[model samples]
Target: MSGSLLDLVKALPTDPSWGPPTTTETMLNGVPYAAFSKGDKLGRMADWTTEGKDREGRGGRQQYNQRYRDQIYGAGPALQTVFNIEGQNEENTFSLVDNSRTTIRTRGFGRGGGTVFRGRGQRGGPTQRGGRGTFQRVGGRGGQQGYDNRGGRGGRGGRRFGWKDYDKPQRNREASVQPKDSWKVVEEIDFSRLTKLNLETGDGEDIDDYGFLYYYDRSFDKQPGAPTSVKKLNVLERAAYNITTSNDPVIQELAERDEATIFATDNILSMLMCAPRSVYSWDLVITRHNNKIYIDKREGSSLDMVTVNENAADAPLEISEGNKDSINSPAQLMMEATHINNVFPLQTVIESDTAKREMPHEHPFYNASEETDPPASKAYKYRRFDLSLEADPEPLHLIVRTELDAVVKNNISGEDQFLTIKALNEFDNRAQGSGGALDWRTKLASQRGAVVATEMKNNSCKLARWTVQSILAKADLMKLGFVSRANPKTSNDHIILGVLGYKPREFAVQMNLNLNNGWAIVRTFVDMVMKEPDGKYVLVKDPNKPTIRLYNVPKDTFEEDEGDGIGMSVVGEDGEE
Candidate 1:
């Protein structure tokens, strides 16, 4: 390396948008640890989130540590922006790389712990033999069988037993009787063998086990806990996507390949945000063009100033917000996207008929034989989002407002459609308790104590502002789950009979139910409109009478800590985004 003033540099663009660098070091379990604390090292793994599930035997905790849905979902802050959804991609099953990971080692506890043999205990308590002495009372000389006795010191404390001294002291002094190692230290990294999806949905919907999180990821953002920023997708009516680049090899490679930036807004901020993962410590990768290095990031000593030195590295390929002209005016960009839909890895550019109206162009990038099937056009709601042609482009979103009358009318007769989803089951990784399937595997409803409503704003032109009518008519419904303990020391130990914390989640299927064709919707309305919810609760399931139970886990209790929450984070606060 050169003895230049700028020894380390950053490759990611800070201007567009990067997630705010994270400093809080903790597992998805809220267990805190230093990011680089050597004491917390678990071999080659440096920043691994957790080991596996341990929520049963050890007081509701499992022998292993596992990542929470939010932890996995939050990992793709950058990916969230470019992708359709964010959350555990568990069922989708994939690896960061194209091929399955090459290593796997799964070690689990044997079943002997739970089995018991009848007729006798493992060993009778204690036995006494050989020359046992008897004691006699001595008052005056010949009162009664007078005798004094002393017995051997109660044999060896052989095989001491009980929960406390569960296992007796063995021969080896160096051997440990109590285990202090967390299962984390022995966790196996089987490459990509196991199936688990860690993602956050860009759209508001809880993952359904049947095929939830099957959606591919295309975005990555770095920011958390700020005014929420959403993922960006090309609508059926939009042409062209955005990409940002820097001189660093990693950054350039990612942009060149259209990999979503970990810092989501990189397409917007120009050079202000920070990327999450980095190759080295201290500083991030900066530019390497023209033989000079630009300022990479805040240094330890002086977190503020930049010292621009001579031909130290290469002057950044003269890139900065002040320069770089490939970006067209927002007006030009917007005008260009009136229509066009595309997928990746294409040598030829495919433009739709709608795109031709906004920006006419002959198909110059492809051979006629290479064109694939055209995508069907979906309805574009410019009127809903309140996008204005007169305003300059900015980072703010223009929330769309749809008219209730138009919405209802469109629902009944319009051709445009939206995606809808309903929950059928939940996936439990802990597999706690007994009864193979029910112990840790069951699909139950999860949501309630929430509200969903639409708000309308008045604008003189009616198009100036708008209203957002929630797809669902009412919210705060109910759902169920297994596992009762509120804060078990171990999640795996939380073995139980049934679902504990039951709540209602706002489950909506974007694909509208053809109201005219479905009578169930009509029936639900009868109950809703008449405030007779219980009138339809008791349904005949063959003939057996089943009892209904209502209970709440202490305040912040969860079902399986892995997915334990009032509502899976996918459904927002109050089950409304």
Candidate 2:
């Protein structure tokens, strides 16, 4: 038998195709032919269950093992058949659905270093089991425990309870004037776009100066917020006017003579220039008639009111938003601040007609017969800034009616320095929306810098607007009075804590305010209006978003209200209202 086996092996070697085939043909019919070494050990021809189990359990390594199995059996085509069978089989198509709850054991550092099971508990709520670091349930229904890493119902890793957190109520301020269906949206410019604009303008030329300024009281400049320095904010019955752009007599005369293409009051113009810094909503009425643009505000506009903590992260909340403190509410605080500003300037100056600085023109809005009280210490300077680009055929100018509050005698030059006085009021520092301000009554003496810095941060928009107005009017100094409420719970009375003075240009530098950017913003809006036809356009700042939209409307849009005498009466050049 051994001799016969030896003869058969010799015969297999003698035959040319008896040994391992060396043919280069890759496929025998439709099956892929895989070349394998003679030393390779062959496994089972087809083990579908094990292959499937390996693939589901071992992932990529199982796939590698399957490939190795395929090479051993030369069954790559058979594996494709098995895949096709599994895909087409109706039995395989139907999956067993487990109705009962499932517990998924995941690798986690649990209690006693065991695996954690995340599953539904007996109380019909999701629970994390077997871990000290397991999520604690909170605010679940029916005594059901729900997984919460932060031990709260909201979510994991939310803002902590603080002034700038979700605990603070949301402020949803209404627009100064809502848009009508008739109004057509012309352009929408974002605050981001306005910030990038820059255009250098020349120092405006003074067209005419109106009104007179009383000499500033030097005694109020003593140590602010001190017992000796604090004074009651008195209500002054002075004729102070905030006339709109189109209603101003001087601007009307300038428009007829074509002195400038654009006209705006310092109030309206400053708001537009400092729009990017503003957090609240405001609207400007832009009337284009006979190639002239007038920027005006609506009757009973919020722009007329001074805001409190407007730029704060957590600004004053409205009473509707669960704020029970009516005195500290946004509307009341605004009224308090506005009243203080109107009276603070008048109180800070000595109303002496003999020692006052009189303008070239008399007070434009003050009347001798119709008004009972004396005129406020105010100076209206109609200044014209050159907004002309090099490409323009004619010089484009903007005439802004800027105001000065008081006049101070310069100690060094002995010249009278013009001043623009604005007040920053403080409510309860412990109250909500205080913007982390210091106690001005105590800190204003030694930590005055810190108090002022806090005011600058919280009241950035208001301060920026005041600075812009001062710079536009060419005022030498900007006086900021620190006013606080007499009682935290009452808005009826206020006390002047202190008066801080700053040079307009220097303050602009510290605030990083770019007048060139403001001029560019003005020019951009001017160009937008210039391109459109003669009509009434409203530039509205979005109440919630940082955007300003320009809408075109009919000429008679706001005329009904104006006809009702809702706005300030038009004052003539002869000081007749």
Give TM per candidate. 0.15, 0.71
Give all candidates' CA lDDT scores. 0.20, 0.79
| Clashes per candidate (backbone, < 3 Å) | 100, 0
Candidate 2 lDDT by residue in tens digits, 291-318:
8888999877788888889988778788
lDDT of 1 by residue, 1-577 (tens): 3432112123222443544453433344643222322122233333355444432335222332333322323222332332323234443676565543444343221321121112222433343122334332323322222222432222122342344443433211111011222211211112121112121112122211110111111121112111231222222221221111222233334344433212111111111111111000122212222221122221111111111110111111111222232222222221221111121101011333432211122221222364343322111111111111234253211111111110111235643222211111111222211111221222222121210100001011110000012221111221111222222232111222221211112222212112221212112222222332211111111111111111111222211232211111111112111
User: Whole-model lDDT, candidate 1?
Assistant: 0.20
Name the 10 consecutive residues with the lowest summed lDDT in model 1. Answer: 454-463
TM-score of 1: 0.15
| Best candidate, TM-score | 2
Give residue 251's error in model 2 in angstroms.
1.0
User: Which ranges of candidate 2 are over 4 A from the true structure?
Assistant: 1-164, 167-171, 563-577
TM-score of structure candidate 2 = 0.71
